[model samples]
Target chain A: MKQQQQAFALPPGAPSIDAMIAAENRRARKRLWTALAFMAPAIGFVAIFLLLPVFFNLYASLTQWAKFSGLNQFAGLANYQRLASNPKFYDATWNTLIWVGVSFVLPATIGLSLAMLVRGVKGEETFKSIFFLPRMFSATAVGVVWYYVYANEGIINSGLRAVGLGDLANRWLYESHLATPAMIVTHIWQQVGLMMVLLLIGLNALPSEPMEAAKVDGASRSQIFRHIVLPLLMPTLIMVTTVSVLAGFTSFDLVWVMGRDFPNRSTLTLSVNQYWESFRAGYWAYGSAIAVVLGVIAMSISWSLGALQHRLDKR
Target chain B: MQKKLSKLLAAVALGVTFTTAAASADPVTVFHDKPFYQSGWDGLTATAKKDGIDLNFSAYATDQFQAYIQSSLMSGDAPQAFTWWNGTKLKEIVDSGQLAPLDDLWAKKIASGEYDASSAAPFTVDGHIYGMPTGLNRWVVLYNKALFEKAGIAKAPATWEELIAAADKLKAAGTTPFNATIQDGWRGFVWFQELLLRTNPEAYAALNQGKLKYTDEPVQNVFKIWTDFYQKGYFTDATSQEEPLDFARGKAGMYLFGDWVIGLVEKGGVKAGTDFGAFIMPNVDPSLPNAVIVEGAPIVITKAGMENPDVVKFTDWYMSENAMNSWATDPGLYAGNLKAKTPNPIIAELAKIAADGKYTSVTRYWEASPSEIVLPAVEEFNRFMTNPSEEQAQKAMANIEAIASQYWASKQ
Candidate 1:
């Protein structure tokens, strides 16, 4: 009775099931090869330009090498050991933490608030464009302009004095305590535009149904934002946070330019410190160690955030 | 099929063009950091052309030059020759074993009485000459003559007391006494160097050589004097624009700068000897002999570059009297060659001072100290200038000592 059933399923003049399976497998194989061929160039580019350099940098971190000199000797963990003992390393790390905190909080808060306030407002595009204008200038140019603005007699001080607040006008770049904060203000000015744009896109893309339903249910605006809008924007918020964290860890150009003229490099972040150690001080091995530490920190943060994002997405 | 064929043909054509270009004569590439000297370099290129050697000259902004040279060297693609600062900065490159000892070339020049062995002292490492001197500059206090006259100063100050008196006169006259620019991080060390040299020249040299500690009494005295100057408001505001500008416009009475500022002064329509005059920074202690800071940019050849005959030939020609003379004529530079005549009157006066044995010539602190020490120490000095506290000075010294110790120990 089973054999009769199988024969009925096959029908007259039909190929065997095994033959059908083999034909499907052949098609899949062909599809895979074509896909791989299409992806080869991109994969090769990432491997050569990104992955290979990262591995090379890791290798360099293990050696006592100076630029323009042969990498002749292996130093094991000596560079990392020095990094652990160096006060400058600690200072740089501390500064990096402050940078990350400020970068995340200031930009995200301002960006989200602006996005909410500007929604459905008159001249919305113009207001957005005005805020986004700073993003068009290169970081170096922004740094140079801000450097003069913070000068002892720069616009900030001059304006304060003009408003009869002369006592408040202080040397902005000269004081170690004020330098980093002053620099952070400049960075926030430059970065707020990006954060606002990203969040604005996320806000616009959100489904209107949930928000409208919450409104009909007599939910307050803040309550609705916290319950519905915030939860839905989690993925984008996570992405924005990761980018801000990365930028904090790698902040160099603006700080370098603003602080280059100042003798006290207390304003140096990890990236700037690495460049100084490797290029200026010729401590390439030590610099590579700093770089490796920074890379690991950045990756760890990204990984943790990505996992959180995945769990949220599943929910 | 036609598109694929055309792509293949295009690739082949591109490969052939690259091969043909590479097959042409290999030029001797030279790197420099002097963007202001295009005409001067043009003259040198003319000399290189006469020798049948194509010269590819590249110039970087001063701040970027060191890193550019370093990366090029590490990549094993360095130019044939490049301009570098003398003293410890040159030693850093020499220690990397990337330089070719120019002993043979230097010996020939010394024998011809064109080059002085003493002048090559800064470029020597392990008893082998690693570089040829390009230009020499002396650090001096350039005072605006008209400004000084208006302030009732009959002549240049000859002592620290006189200098203070002059400053008071200038301040009363509503002009800044001294125009110092820390806009360039390296320039922050100028006052520190000048003060240290005035206090104790020997200790200053030892400090630069990493033998004397920054906490030493001589160094402390330097800080004390510098702090006093800051307190008295003898210096222009810390935020003032770069030197020679303030001095040229008569907004500032004096500027302590290298001879290179003379060109800028000339450009600002101020005559060197007439409108402005150079004077040695007076010794703080009358018991000490006069001292001056001297610096020279050196041109160094790479080891691989020496293997190329054209590079070797070009280097030799570049250091010759004819080439240096051409450079001196255009840029008004004082050649490192002892025999090269100085047509610039102010440079002639400086040359005379340098030739005299009474005044000791010390290497500028920026180039004399190891980069590890200088990089941090200058920052500390910059801070100290603004804050002007003993505690800050002590902290700065300690920081410098810590870096210097680590660097020197690792070297050993």
Candidate 2:
């Protein structure tokens, strides 16, 4: 490090990030570029599987394909136009809105509460392990387990009957209005640990200096959290929010697993409908349209959330 | 001791290697759709192998086959033949020039009064045949004998009013009368078919074809009965919760399902005769005897497979003397061959039901809809199950019409 510093002198003002990063790594920029060149295989994989497909899907939504005959025709805006008029397109949009929003808000809030409780608690590790165990299981398995718990004659109903409230018990996932909420609660339970873990990482990264300053200044715990420490934790919050939003938006396995054939199909997000319409029902053109809309909505939502978080982080 | 240990180790190693090598021979690439049927298929594979066919038996859940069958047909290395449904689904495959019409080969047998060509009717289009029907299904309302006995009901309800009253009696006795699982749009379709048959059986064919609009009153009647039953709690949370089969298994009073359900019931360790009895889902018009819809599967020989002498021989033998008896053993299914009959007593009851005169026959809605309409209608059916207010149901139906107009009109 000292050898690199002898060759490089900083400008008078605070060094830019590029300069510091460049200073940290003493290699020439060309060698760095060569290192990136060596990483071309991984970059190619991301381009093919992720970026190229996304771009192709964007193109497909604008076009049309018959399920049986395959894609040779291009329908342009007509697919999107039909989507706007389709009620299920709207149903999926509403469900997506609910799912993504709850997916972020519920898990984040639970995580915050959990992290706050665990930080000062004894056996923090044990609580975190207990809460996070479900995260290790696939969402599909979690969904099935919960389905049994919430079934008519399953654990929940059995408890209700034991307490002489059997008449009051009804199918939790049966009623469409309640179905979405029920699924969301199960999601939040399974997801809270992740939120807690991410926040704990951020909490651990907190420097003692700023927190001690707030304490000495006669600020309460909440005040310290609201001001100096929270401000310092802004980047972590943004990252957590960004990941949660993406996971929430693309969550097909949980919803599909929970409500395999749930009534009104209103519990259906754009992904589920896209699959059923294309695969089960053989409406590839319409399904492709749904998929495109879903992709747009998901990308836009994540981008917007991340931008908001970044602005707050900058503050 | 060391010498004995080495001898035992050497012998164990030799046994495993020999077994592994023998077990790893070429598989007979069978693309079956029913794993339930595949239990019996394990028996028939020997017959398949006798003609030098390697056993690569592959099976899919019913839904996956519906999605991938087209692609399978186009692939050059597709399975020799698969268990495809014997209806508009099969007809579509044959039309694509992908499926080989087995008519020319099966013709002599059809003429000689061996194969029931009538059962092959759904697999026929332009008078060309595609495959044989495996299960002769007769849709009926199966009731629990214990539930009926507990309710003091001596016989299966013979009329619509009686059935409703029977349901009411069971409800009073604290049991859900109907075992319905409508989380799938198709379950709601059961009541829809039942109501349609009871009210307006004659209108079914037109309804199946593009000739009938979904908004027609007869179709509306199907949903009305569905809504009414749903509101009454005649069914306990079938639409939202799964395991309606569990409801039947757990002794929910009655189930309006096909004969395929017998295998499921049996798997649940429920006795066929003692646990349940079959009767047509009665409609109020006692004068008009009720009918049940028959949905079935068939074997489609690829056109290219026709040129191969070995494939033709396999097909010929598969259609011959003892194969029908072989296929019937598992669930005791009635074969497409007129010469075959099930020995099972439960299936014998369905056989009697099939002989009734006023049968309102139409292909399944998924197969019958003009290509684009199926998905939208599925959505409509799904939306309806949510206990959507009348307004939402109307919106759903209207959207279905729009899909119909948008897709079907273009085709015409």
Candidate 3:
């Protein structure tokens, strides 16, 4: 009765302010629901394909499940324990660190240096394409090409012989010391392009005012870059480093193709070793253990790098 | 009119679907690693069809066959039958009790005198027949006859000295005497095995069983012999980029491989008997009867596949003399079936001699050695072959020995 009296008490031609507010709230809610409906498919896809599989992989890594076996024993930490004592596991992990270090440090630095040097050059795009050409090639192709280059009588030896350095024409992939380095060189060749491209974009987007101020204060190019450009490019550096690090951990094809038949088994990486252990050796659980460790190392590195990048970017 | 038309169309559609289903089910799935084992697989399938068999033959390349088999078997989606190496490979599944026992089938055939005695013993393990033996009983020197004749060497080499002489002659004739796929790390072991076969067969088996030391005198001799050949320029220093396909294509005078050489020769589009012929490696000692290294691949049936009643019928049909003969007589394959008539006279001679109790089939170390050890060791062997100094050879042997000892100790 009171609501009816208020409505009746309202004069004709007067706007209803309370009703307007309520209608606006209802429109906002409807828009929000519509936006959610629009995003539903993408959310569903991510949950199904990416997020769910990661959890499934985690579950798989903890079990003694094989393709045919119905048995999925909940083997908590047994895989980890076995990994601790496994000699090949230790070797692979050590090699993976070396690979990660090379992939993370060498590629990013070289690619960055090249990008910085070429960023101001004439025909920079052409040079960029040349450097990035290898990135387009499959890691297998990179391995094969490098394998030939390092072969006993291949181009390296052929060049060495032309200069009367035939004694230096030793086995590159087969030598105990040279195998990992050979694989590293191949990785660098395959990786440097992406780094250069990422950093170039960051460098191109750098604000000019700080660099201009540094120049006005009689700072040299290196000083200006050190003080202004690099400080600003920290986010990109972290990004390149993080990407390279993850790639190093996940690297399989180059190591597989280049170090496939090395005399010393020292070149075996976690990925390669895991593959052989599972498929060839039929030690499925143990191989899965190696993969889990690799995943952990990758995740830790990626997470820390992401956090670092975030902090620096915010600052 | 519309109703009648719809009824007729629906009837036709139903008929088409049922026939397609029937056609797909009509095929007997036979998985093979040797697609190029005959002239064309289509021709081979046609010939099999003539024998009243509808073989839906799926062939894999040499490299792809294992993973294909594993996926098919492990998924319980295998073709009714398939092929792989025997011993360790077969034992992987056989030991799991997944393989069907064919002992009864063998016994029935033997009682009827339908199967040869010598062929049965090698595939027999723990008195249970896991599979049928499907390879030539030995490794032989497959030499180009025309190349040999051009080099003025009359007949194949008969002894170690003669082999050296023939090799030297072939070298003198400007041909790579021995074909080695050095880049294909696994193929490098051919030299090792051949040397072992010449020097000591027992030691070879012991090495394969991980009983002999990798750096032992016999094993060292194997490497020493290989390096000596390399040092003498009998092999290439950097053929790691080359595969056996390249080796075959390059037209080397001789390729040391097993029974499937005949098919490879056919695939090469060359005359088998005239252009190339294979013979057992010459006896190192005249006092001892010449023995050939036997590598048998067994066709083992899986339990999951066996569960299918249709699959059982196919397996039963597989062991029939007709099916065996079809594979054996086609392109003259050295089949596992002892009773199957072989078109290859040379293999027939050896098969008969083995059956008559004159020749002994030395089991292949390749088939016996665990793959984990073998695969790595071969890579090392390939590496050493590239350098091939006495020190490198010894060190490689030591590495192999360590892995072997560790593996055997674990097995114990």
Candidate 4:
């Protein structure tokens, strides 16, 4: 490398390769600084609003900070111990797991099915818009609408009674065992639209020639879907799955608005329980611990999924 | 020219000094969680203005106000006065040394015949009264007179047996007997408080103080009665959000709530004393004293807030009977001031019943217990409401006792 640099050296009183390299390095550093200067506002915003709060929240979880009592009194590991001992926390975890598990299956399967059904069909835009309408409303509004549908005198029970199945009519949201499932159904109803749109985009982006060639080669429709389309749609599926998982972990508004007084807080997810504990019950430190646990679970799963996507892309 | 310039500079300096002085004359900010009483607060604000103290009022949703105020207090910045619940709820903040004792104000008001000593008892903590009553609400059974008439009931039930019979009659007449709900998570405790106090007031008080276990026989008996009501189909749907609306529509025979429900009922197009009438729930055991649960929200001033002279002036004027009249009459609220007149006849009648019976007033169950316990216990109470059976009641009681025991144990 040194011999090559000497061979490329400039004449005397002119710049040498080393001098030129130094000047180039200086310009590169200046360009880097310019880029950083452009990005500084966004970095500062994330540091201040997101990163700082997360770090402070981590610190707060170790302290005993009730709303008014014992502010910032450090009781190391005590909050986590309390969280471990709490049966409600465990119930919340189990409910959250059900939500996360549902996020994986329902959105992908239903979304992909609808996407395929509507793609290249007559009035496809109309059907897609109809399916996507619920996504346009806020979660709270959707909850309010569905609250009436699940209410005792709501459409479901009313329809049941009209069909001479009055005995089958039940209080859907009131039953403890049914509450989580009912809420999950509502979540899936709202989430499938986004998943469908993303998957539809991916389907449209695929090369039609490969699918046509597969069909010509005596491949069945299912075989073509499995071998040709599914592999290409993997990236969009992973993206949709990641979003659904995060949504499942962080769902609060629907459950809060719909499950007014869920039996024993049975409908409470970790997010709802955290708000209930911190804001409602004044257990700030313990709630922060629950939040930290939720964050860790969500972050680790998301990281693993992202790594999987990266490896698949490399292949 | 120099003389004219000097005069202009002096005038500017005087104007700046006056502006600074005006800015330093701070308005006393009073916070309350009652959005329904915004007009009443505005009336009080007007009255405070006439007293030369500017009053700025802020209202928050009930659920968020505690968190907002507590954090504000801990940060050494809070409004001059804010409404808070009584009993252990008040005691918790007082224990944190965030409140200023209002013993002097209480004594002054009592001496001036504007307030009663008993009205100050709920706000008393460790022998120092930390707040003044915002209002006194007595819980009573507000019955639909039309429903009662249709059910062949001549008047309000004066005994527990009669109450049950009325409920049965109402149910047979194809109307929901009571407008009961578990909505908002707090209403579940209403019947629990009502029945427990009627059955055994001492046990009710003891349970709230952590001296009586929630699984005790007295509480269990109350649960059994509640379960029986559910089995008999005497209650509207537990998850119903329309407690006041149901009663207003005459679909329910009775609604047990604070006298404050009068405004909601009237707003629902039902006249107070014409369409509906209220009566104190008779004691199940005549051997026990006549008791009523009273919910009192108090306005607590922080230590720093008390140091401000404008806040002091506003608070003093607030304790006057004139202020109470302005604050309560327009809203049909029950004023804590002894001399204040109730504009709503139903409240007046209910007040007369309590006064005539010389009823022993117990603090409400929601505010009587520690919030840490009460908030979760209400959820259990709600669970019991959803599935009201002997087994469910027992389970609910056990769960509630576990929560209460944990809270009390932590205190120890």
Which segments of candidate 4 are over 4 A away from where they belong? A1-6, A16-35, A69-72, B1-20, B23-26, B45-53, B329-332, B353-357
DockQ of each: 0.49, 0.37, 0.25, 0.66
For candidate 3 chain A, which ten residues in a row score worst on lDDT?
A63-72
lDDT of 1 by residue, B1-412 (tens): 9999999999999999999977776777778998777777887788777767687778998657887888787787777789998888888788777889999998889899877666677677889988777677889989989989998999999998998899999989988898876766767788999988887888987887778888889888888888777777788766554456667888689899888778777777788888888888898789987777888788889898899888888877877787777677663576666676664678878877666656777788988887778888887887776677778788887887777877777778
Output the better candidate (1/2) by lDDT. 1
What is the CAPRI rating of model 2's predicted complex? Answer: acceptable
Residue-level lDDT tens digits of model 2 in A237-311? 767777776777777888888876675466888888788777776766777778877877877887888788768
Give one digit per residue, the lDDT tens place, for model 2 in B1-412.
Answer: 9999999999999999999977875353557777767766875676556656654467886667766775555444456667776656666666667667787767888787776555666677788878756666767777888888898778999888889889999988888888866654555566655677677766666766666667777776676777777778787555444443564555478887777777666666666776777787776577775556676667777766676555676677667656666666676466556566564667766664454435654455555555456655665666566553566566666777766766657868
Tell me the native contact fraction for each prediction.
0.76, 0.49, 0.22, 0.69
Best by DockQ: 4
Query: Would you give the TM-score of chain B in model 3?
Result: 0.83
Where does model 3 exceed 4 Å of error?
A1-87, A117-125, A159-170, B1-26, B31-54, B57-79, B102-122, B132-137, B144-152, B168-177, B206-234, B243-254, B261-276, B304-358, B409-412
What are the models' TM-scores?
0.88, 0.83, 0.79, 0.94
lDDT: the better of candidates 2 and 3: 3
Worst 10 residues of 1 chain B by lDDT: B237-246
Model 1: how far residue B368 lies from native, Å: 2.5
Per-chain TM-score of chain A in candidate 1 equals: 0.90
Q: Candidate 2, after superposition: displacement of residue A287 in Å? A: 2.6
What are the per-residue Cα lDDT tens digits for candidate 3 across B1-412? Answer: 9999999999999999999977777666667786655533454456557866666667776545665666566665665567767767667656545567778767776776657756666667677777765565567777778788888889888777888898899889887787765554466677788788778877877887777888888887777778888788776444456533433454567777776655545565565666677767775655665677777776666766667666666555565666667667556476556767765655666677667776668766667788768876776777677677888888888877877888889889
